[model samples]
Target: MNVAENEIKSVMDKYRKFAVYGLSPDPTKPSHYVPLYMRDHGWEMVGTYPKPHEANGFTIYKSLTEIPKEYRKFIDVFRASEKIPEVVDEAIALGGVEVLWLQLGIHHAAAEAKAEKAGIKVVSNRCLIIEHKKWF
Candidate 1:
């Protein structure tokens, strides 16, 4: 299901700090640049990388649980569609995740439902940069 534009705007407005799940160390990838774009736009971002590596000076945690609780309020995911369930599981397990945002081209209905059921707002198949530019 598509998230409404107003809900998207509200999600963006309510959560300024978020964790980037599946963040890449490569600067060329959206997993890298999207978080950078958000950071540049004044969003406080930390990230989860498979390995210990830095992305444009942002703190890269090895997993969601590694991210401090305060920064776990929102998660901007960049993993493949198939990987979303695992991400959602991790987010739910981690708790305190107010929103789960799957970036453009990423969507998983089951996972979205799971997240929403767990009291996290889900925004799927949308680009945070694009929405931010349009709404704010």
Candidate 2:
């Protein structure tokens, strides 16, 4: 969809529900705290973790494929950069993801391109919590 730099702010504002990939249970981790901040600010969150566990009341799906299709609108990925492509592939397979976000310090151009090619907006090297605080 080719989101322009100027349009990113608007795109980020539109997203409210997200599936957080690699979410951790540890309270100190960015993967945990960032999404917790978002949820506290009224965003709906789901977790995609290898283990089944709850995160602040959000259900943890074992995999992206396990998340309900209706809640697959946005995916906040916290995995290593090398693992982004696989996450993007799962998002694409889910068919309803509107955005694929790489947490701050994480980026994979090929995966970003792949998700963008599938009509998903790509946000790389950004913190969702920071963006929300800035824009909302």
Candidate 3:
């Protein structure tokens, strides 16, 4: 399999739950809609927002550490590219992160490398909805 395919397979085989970092309350935003879509399609989703809030019935946490350990295994990030290193650091610190998924238009090479070095699979600049549709 190609690298992307392999990564997707690995993530699919391992994690049923995911945490969205920077999940927005706005329905029009992909950050809001993508996780909702995933939830509807049977992927358990929790989120980390800047503040404690609810977005479309999903609980939003204030930090990665606040998310349950099982949900922390797959983190799909929606923060800006420059914000990724901090997110990476948080994921590394929190530990047990199996995959770090950077949403479409977000990419940080150094952060991705750091995540990979820490043994976390990194997928960047990809839409989770698009990929899920394509793969399954």
Candidate 4:
């Protein structure tokens, strides 16, 4: 279920809680700030990173599997393309994941296909913050 470019906004509107993979600790980084912006806008966000880190006091999972199943509805991925497949696979295994979103400059066709095939809405290479700004 690859979401068309124009439908991204509608998709964004549909989900409230988001699990951001590769979310950074640095406030200046896109992975951090993008989710932060969403959080500030009344969106609920949790984060997962390779290392232990905090994003505005939110519990940052060390891996996707660590996230609670109910919080996996929308996954906004900030990982590089090379790392996406594993994340996508984990998302699928986690279940209840409605959307798989790859952040700006990150795109993995295989991963996208896998998620789409699993009936998860897929959006690639788009900045969530930029998209949110347009619709919110």
Candidate 5:
């Protein structure tokens, strides 16, 4: 299972927990289904948002700072491409965030650079669910 050029998947291979940013509470939302699908493939997924609340039977975090220390390995983002820079910053602040995965159709050069510069691997414009499926 080769990750992209920038994303090596080392942290992904070593970690079981995943923090999903921009996760939608609504089941009909694409952000909701994509991570949900990845969860079905044996990946532990945590839903995150910009609000401190609850959604889909899970607690919503206002930012990556809200994530717990133990589960900070992979940070998957589903927001607009333009917002990725902020996500990258959040990932760096959280520490131990290995993979900075932007959801399908989302990409930003600056964000990728930020993550890479901070030693976090980058995977933009890719779907974790789809990648898992293809790998298996």
Candidate 6:
């Protein structure tokens, strides 16, 4: 479940759909800008946040569970590192999540273990948008 070079590209190529948890309305925020960047990079992004009904001019859902059963493979988490335990638990419950991404500066060993145990590929303390750009 740990990420490797091949796994990263496989997720991007196979599952272009993404749910951005904690997506923000403010452009200045990392949560807001990362998803926007992904959308611009050709990834279909779903804003999953409680505060914003819309982000980057697209409607935002409250959680991954709210997203239709079909789109769950791509998930990028922007929650605090300390809160990752709860977030990871939620992701495990939300079926079909292929990639569990933790944004830059976020890391939780216990949550990472749980996600891996659930057979979910995890990328911790990394930036997906940045990685995409770098690879391209």
- Backbone clashes counted, model 6: 0
Q: Model 3 over residues 1-136: C-alpha lDDT tens digits?
A: 1137556755765677989998999999999999988888789989988877778889888998888998999899999999999999989988899888899999988988988989988888888889888777
Residue 27 alpha-carbon offset, candidate 6, angstroms: 0.7
1 or 3, greater by lDDT? 1
Please, what are the lDDT tens digits per residue for candidate 4 over residues 1-88?
3898789878888888889888899998998889878888888888888799767877898887888876689998888799888988
Task: State the lDDT of candidate 2 residue by residue for 1-136, as single tens digits.
Answer: 2566677678766777778998998888999999889888888888888987767777898988888865678888899999888888888887889988888999998888988988888888889877787777
Tens digit per residue, CA lDDT, model 6, 1-136: 3888666766667767777888888889999888778778887877778764666586688777887655567678889999999988888886687788888999999899999999888988888777787676
Top-TM-score candidate index:
1
Task: Write model 5 residue lDDT over 32-118, tens digit each, in one string.
Answer: 887777666677777677655556566567767777866567777888887777777877876888777777899888778777878
lDDT for position 36 in model 5? 70
Q: Tell me the spans in candidate 3 whose CA falls farther than 4 Å from its real position.
A: 1-3
Worst 10 residues of 4 by lDDT: 63-72
TM-score of each: 0.95, 0.91, 0.93, 0.92, 0.84, 0.91
Clashing pairs in 1: none
> Higher-TM-score candidate among 1 and 2?
1
Please tell me which model should have the higher lDDT, number 1 or number 5. Answer: 1
- State how far residue 27 of model 1 sits from its true place (Å): 0.9
lDDT values, one for every candidate: 0.88, 0.83, 0.86, 0.85, 0.72, 0.80
Error of 1 at 88 (Å): 1.0
Worst 10 residues of 2 by lDDT: 1-10
Cα error, residue 42 of model 4, in Å, equals 1.3
Question: In terms of lDDT, which candidate is stronger, 3 or 5?
Answer: 3
Residue ranges of candidate 4 with Cα displaced over 4 Å: none
Q: Give the candidate number with the greatest lDDT.
A: 1
Q: What is the lDDT of residue 20 in candidate 2?
A: 90
